[model samples]
Target: MKTKINLIFPMVVMALFLFIGHTSAQPAIITQWTFDDTIEPSTGEGTASLIGGVTQHSATMSNGWRITDFPEQYVGSGTAGAQFIVSTEGYQNIVLDFGHRSSGTMSRWAEIHYTTDGGANWQVLANNNGDLTPHDVVYPFSFDFSSVAAASDNPLFGVRIVSIFSPVAFNPEAPDSTFAANTAYHRARTPGTGGNPYSGDGNWRLLEVTFAGEAIMPGGAEKLTIVDFNGGNIPELNVPFYLTVQTQNINNEPTAIEIDTEVSISVTSGTGSLNGTLAQVIPAGEHTLSFSDLTYDVAENGVVLTVAATSGMVLEPAISEPFEVVYPLENIIAKWTFDDTTEPVIGEGVASLIGGVTQHSASIGSGWRITNFPEQYDGSGTAGAQFMVSTDGYQNIVLDFGHRSSGTMSRWAEIHYTTDGGANWQVLDNNNGNLTPHDVVYPFNFDFSSVSGTANNAGFGVRIVSVFSPVAFNPEVPDSTFAANTAYHRARTPGTGGNPYSGGGNWRLLEVTFLGEPLGILPGDANCDGIVNILDAVTIVNYIMTGNVHPFCFDNADVNSDGLIDVLDVVGTVNIILGRVRK
Candidate 1:
């Protein structure tokens, strides 16, 4: 019967992003083929050889050395043994797809070697064959060409297929032939072959060997583009700032490519400094720098830049684009300003106001306050101002209030929140107690538990209403001291309220923490920067469909940690959008 060969397709998908520019323009193509075809004996030319009595045909080898029905076997002679060859001018990745067909054998060997100068010298590129018993072997094999040496003058390269039957051991007959003895059994030997003659039946068939060419499109030079800057300048003082950058493709297509790049900023003529590395997916369009605590004594005048590809790939000259550093005014005291016309009232130690009011300012005593409370301290209509505060789906809202007097005031504050734009509000937090003043600050905390809305419905503000005691006040206390009992709303976590004593000092409007999923209003809420648009959806889908997880997962893209992402997480994300679940 003619030799029977079965074709197996492994489950493997490979995707690579290449930066192409005019100087480094090179088209890449991935080649795949299995060496199972048979040719007549006379057809064997160059390195080709004949197998069995027939000309050229694939065969299932039972014994290690036997090439055909004759039974005469040939063992490996020296370091330069059996192999194949191919050419590489501008190649990036070389993929080998194969499957192991065995019952319960341990060791099976197959390796790919390349020679830069003809077949004279060969370097091992990859070696793969594991100890999986009853091996179904339905997985594609992939090897990155990043570690291999580049092809210079003689760009022509060839592949060598090395197959060894005998275990690696010192041979007494040919002492120099063997290196060391290996107790591990290799599947290359037949069962009946007495361990010496190399028996057992095993074969390695070349299912497919694909040489993927690199596609270096024009303008594909990998470089960093400064998109935006905070404070408008660098080398700024204790003032925090951010930087936005993008990675472009050869065709100038803004592809979300992550590059291992660095960023450093300094003054033009002055002496200020800031440095950091590019991390995670910079997205396609633009991104902002998350650096918040930078100090600059003088203004930034000059700027230096540098960049390089992670691997041996030589990036175009655009990698290092230098620009000037312009610094804005530095070091301005942050004080809370309030919109006085909004309220201007303080009832019997109680104040309440409607939500969605915008006329407000920062405060020195209170980070954010509602001005003009009812003159007298009594329970009345509306007392406080209601406003909305949202996070980029990364942080939660924490509100704190304090009564600074020795007066018994029955005080209380309630936090009403809604995922839908004020269409509904859920009571998140509430407080009630005596205001025995002596610089006492009570922190009312809300974890946004009910704020389980998508990034779309992430639009949420707070409606804060405080009530004070209706009792007599000690005349010893000054009126201005208790004139406006301060109340502040800050975005912070438990035990993380900065400068709580000063009330409004050092407080921020947004606090990005490493807890909870960034609010997902729609599919793309990967980084939870709070917009359920295309970017967010693409981030989630890419991770799920493709086995690539960029740092953007911190934005809520990694629904499950299965190493492989899928749509199941997207389903839960959809639930969050419907207000069915909170991330």
Candidate 2:
């Protein structure tokens, strides 16, 4: 009994060691050629070629490489094929795999060959030649070269697959003359028994020629990891953010080569979808990938990003840490539709008649309509309509609206805006930075997004009024008649339109809006209640002196934006509340 037990234990231990050794060995990708994008190998180093009379070409059909101009079936056998040359340095247990299919009249049998000296000499793989039975659909084939010690770790290693004639069952020494001549052997032939003979016009298509082996060093990538974010993970809604990804091996190190793989990010947990440049191709010899200008519209919590590679890349998808997408701080400060409502729909504002221009209910549309005007081109730069809106907690103010003119109205108008409560005004210029042409038409947005001192002002206002063209005052005197496109005032007056000065025509306005982005932190509002006052100064002082744990905004406490909250900041805050300074 003791002898039998000892023998069984030794055998069991041997089997265990063999299983562990086999399972530890993983096949690393030495090279791969898909021919989907470039003629170069997809993963590592390799060059493809055609043997004998075969011609190789690239096409988008199934993203495969094609070989054409073959010899007649059963003729030139064991000669025509495709070859892939690669260096298997730092690898062992080499293997070659590919997918191939043939046209109806193409040769069916092919043999795999290898050359350890870079195609100078070749040797046929024993008993590896077989029939490729499928047509159009790919049939997979693999060859193991573990016994060929000379093929491993060789820089000049190469392999090729060639068409070969198969022996007939009755005549073992002769070629199979009827292999592809009958209907059963061709894809497009009729069901009847008789068919045409195989022709050289037929061709073969091959894809995914992969060369793999056990690596002596770190190898192919197994997973992806997000390395960094250009705009941070918790970005504002509708704001663009870029992210970087790295391809990592099983040991969590960046792979040596992550080429030809496409990487993309998808919103796996949020209602919003990713927009703009979602996927990027990993360039040759590069392991890190980057995306550009990705945005989400809706603010939501637990927004997760799933970074994925293409299916053929054989990489595990990665998940990003859950992060929240917050609402954009900027908002519409005030908007007036002038469609039965003259006040702003968003915030505090009012639209009122000014400059002797009265409102009419029924003309071009429901808006502020003006008719009466000073004689031809007289009140050009001095009269029209006015809009007042407060941008108290916002910056980067902009304006948009719609305006129309009657056929008889003046063709030119001046756009005037005030940032200091109408104390001073500046004329908005055309896109060319000129104020004379006034070429702006209806439904336009005037950008003040880059202009300074146009935001957070309680006295902000805008005025659109009549203006005379520069052509009318070429000699410093008003032209007696209106230009070709000019119109008279509300009523026809004598000597208008090629006559003396006359007042005739009308103007209509609607949908005036003021937009701005919320300030990151209101300069003097230490408590962050959307206002600057005495309490803000007191809040700053109390927090600094007593370390009081009251509600506070550190950014607001630094009133001068100098990264400090001391007596100087307190003084700046006081100046703002006392109307002695402006932010």
Top-TM-score candidate index: 2
Weakest lDDT window of 10 consecutive positions for candidate 1: 505-514
Candidate 1 deviant stretches above 4 angstroms? 1-29, 36-82, 99-107, 129-140, 151-154, 165-185, 188-197, 200-202, 218-583
Cα lDDT of model 1 by residue, 1-583, tens digit:
0111222323122112222211143434333333434311111122333222212224322211112121112333112223434455434443333333332232344455667787677677755543222232322344555456554212455665443333455232211144353332344333343333222233333333444445434444355455455546543333455555445554444444443333333333334454443333332234223334444432222444333233422333222233343223111111112223222221111122442222244443443433343334443323444544333333333333332221212234455555454576666655533322322543333455334442222355555544432223222223223323333222222243232222111211111111123343333367545554456556677765664433254435544544444677676566666667655
Task: Please give each candidate's TM-score.
Answer: 0.25, 0.34
Instruction: Provide the overall lDDT of each model, using Cα atoms, as 2-decimal numbers.
Output: 0.37, 0.66
Off by over 4 Å in 2: 1-275, 278-330, 362-366, 430-441, 472-504, 522-583
TM-score of 1: 0.25
